[model samples]
Target: MDQEKVNILLVDDQPAKLLAYEVILKDLGENLVIASSGREALEVLLKTEIAVILVDVCMPELDGFELAAMIREHPRFQKTAMIFISAIQVSDIDRLRGYEMGAVDYVPVPVVPEVLRAKIKVFAELYRKTRELERLNHELEDRVRARTAELEASTAKLRESEQRRSMAIAAGKMGSWDWDWISGDWMWDEGQYRIFGVSPEDFEINPANVQARLHPDDVDQLRKAIAEFNKGTRAYETEFRIVRPDGEVRWCVGTAAATMDENGRVVRVSGVTVDITERKRAEERQNLLAREVDHRAKNALALAQSIVRLTRADEVKAYVNAVEGRINALARVHTILSLSSWQGAELSRLIDEELAPYSLGEQIKLAGPEVQLLPATAQTLALALHELFTNSAKYGALSTRAGRLAIDWQVDDELLTLSWEESGGPLVKTPQSRGFGTRSLLASIESQLGGQAQFDWRAEGLLCRLEVPLTRKTAAAAPGKFDTAGSAELQRASG
Candidate 1:
């Protein structure tokens, strides 16, 4: 279907006019030959086959009319198309003379660009069709002499194709079967025996045996499909589950076409059954991920609502800052969880992220074994650490250059014990009442994570101890509600 590009000859005495003609015909994707005079055009025509000629009628010597006459007189260019472009009005007598000189079309002083392109396209396409027909006539005679060899090659290719089809069916885990249900006759290929997990020597080719291998839930559905196929349905498709001999269940899909007799009765059915177990499993995993994402999104929204509801400060800006700080801490935890596929977050990473803004140097020391916290626990602990860091930057060990803080943790007796001690800052004093930060911190360890927190306000600084069970219970409090459930002794220990 791909045609060769033909040559379009643009002839004019003026260089600018020839350049303009080349620009207009460039997009036609044809080979354009430009000539500044009729003599140059004639030389080009003698060297190349021209399909369409655009000639300026007012050339200095051997003008458009004279040039067309000379081209038409040549035996090889007798039928070549010529279009004349004139910069002056042509009288009716001039037009008659131009037609006699082999001009097929003419344009006035100003040409309509679209009209000129349309006229040239028609002649070019006609020339291409004529050339193609001549080439086909030459090829027809040679085709008759090579027909026998082509037939032999086709036979060999068909045999190779059949072998490739069998290999493809096996590689694809697909099996083909033909069943004459009316006569209780069934035949299966090698791939079918593999799919059914049965050996041909031990398996009986019967409908009852096949039915027995189908899952009980899918039996009726497949039977209905077969019934429809037998009742004049030309094609039918169904998906079902099959239980193999070793108690392994697999998913499969069947596509079949019914062969009908002259009386419109289906005599036989043939089709392919493809194993779709892997595809089914992938779909199940995708669905599970969708549900998990939805659940986690709701939980995150609820946690944000809780931070907004529980946060408290004297000024509006203070309250907003408190809420934002806690939410930002929660967001960081979510980021860590996402990076780990929501499996968990490392305890040290969470601590480092919260304390990073404080710019703590050698004055602060940290010692802990690597521990991964669940999503809920990580969120709660991250918020608690953010509160602790905010307090230290404001009044505790990190408040002065001379101040010091040490954090350490260890796992013992199925419990993780983390201690935070501070020194060399303002004198410690216990608060008169528990604030939002203290209440949230207590709730995180006790209610949310099922742990304990004790704060000792010594004269030098503050020391806090937290104890959380390794196999902790799920959080008892829903989001948007920071549970205040704890022992009075623990409440008294809050600073």
Candidate 2:
């Protein structure tokens, strides 16, 4: 069919006869090879891919029958068709013997060339069809293999996508459920079982089981939400508490929407639930802390006003100004504590917040380890730093444009040491009288933090040093152990 020629082999003992057969088959449009004997024919068959063989019965070493039998024995030539030609009249036994040796047809000598050519043509066409069918079968098999590989790859991608989606839902603490009102069928995601604190196998798709888990006070609210959802008047959105079988109560928020039929009748309900117990508790704690902060701020302002009244002198303006500044500093510390939920404050952040009110130039140097101070310690230190800053601004280093303060702090051997050194100030001398600002600074550091305070007045400038024990209880405890009477005595002596 593809216009490719088929090859035919002719075997005989005489050269003239071989040439005559080749000339007869030349018009048949096939490639023809002529061999003078059975050995020559076999040699030709081995060299070329022959489709049909024509043999002469009488030969020298091997006859046509013997050659046909030999060809059948070889696997490569088993499908080749063989025909025998004889000069003598053939007997029935001779025809049967030729057939047994794999001959398909016999022709007498002086054969009709047209008939012989027609028979060879039939066998050639059959061989061509068999090869074409095999080619088609191989192509079909290759296509099937490619399609199967694509299907396998697609299946793997689908599995990977499902795994990622499931992981995301679990990590977000989201639970989903679907309920069919008509058939009473329910399907819950794995996260739903975890949120309810119930084993998946123990769950029943019934309204009674769901209602049983609700807290006594929350049952009515949950029922109301569900009733409203079923009536089609509203979607289900509610926050309620559920008591687990283990006697632990948890808060959960649930949202549901109904799937309605054409007539607006509810057919299914699908929803998600989330655990919000920890979030609710944190909000409650924040509210309580805010109220406490307000109370403490009021008490601090009252105490400042009392100090101004008791220490007032002929210089009323200066006394009021100093008292107001100190009170404002205390308020700023409280604001920082509130931002941190009263846990603590970063030492550096506290210093920056307190010094923002003063117009100290960038030349004021601060060096320290990064330390977190407790709320009480932050308050005490803020007050002490404010007093020092005020004193320097009025008469010490900060009063002059060229003056500078170098502040440094460190922790060594479980004690915190902070030193403030001033330079470029006028000649320094000890003050004759103890002032409220000086007294407050010494009292807060020594009494509240269980620390020592020392001041040295030198010709160059003033140097203030504080050494505080880095113990947890005295610095952070609600009620500290440092005696107020002893702190007052130390403040008077130091001032």
- Cα displacement (angstroms), candidate 1, residue 418, comes to 1.4
Which regions in candidate 1 have their CA more than 4 angstroms from the true location? Answer: 1-148, 163-171, 483-495
Residues 116-153 of candidate 2: C-alpha lDDT, one tens digit per residue: 88888888877777777878889988888988988988
Q: CA lDDT, every prediction?
A: 0.83, 0.77
lDDT of 1 by residue, 1-495 (tens): 666999999999989888777777877889999988889999999999999999999988789999999999999888899989999989989899999998899977567777878888999999999988888977886796588679878988998898898988888899999999589699899988889899889999787899999999999977798779766899999899999999999999999998898899988889999999999999999999999998888878887877776665667876777677777888888899999998888889999988777777798899999997877778777777777777777777787899999999998987889899999987777766776667778877887788999988787888999987666756535765663211111122223
- Runs off by more than 4 Å, candidate 2: 1-49, 59-75, 86-122, 174-176, 214-243, 247-374, 377-435, 438-495
The C-alpha TM-scores of every prediction are 0.65, 0.55
Of candidate 1, the 10-residue stretch with the lowest lDDT total is 484-493
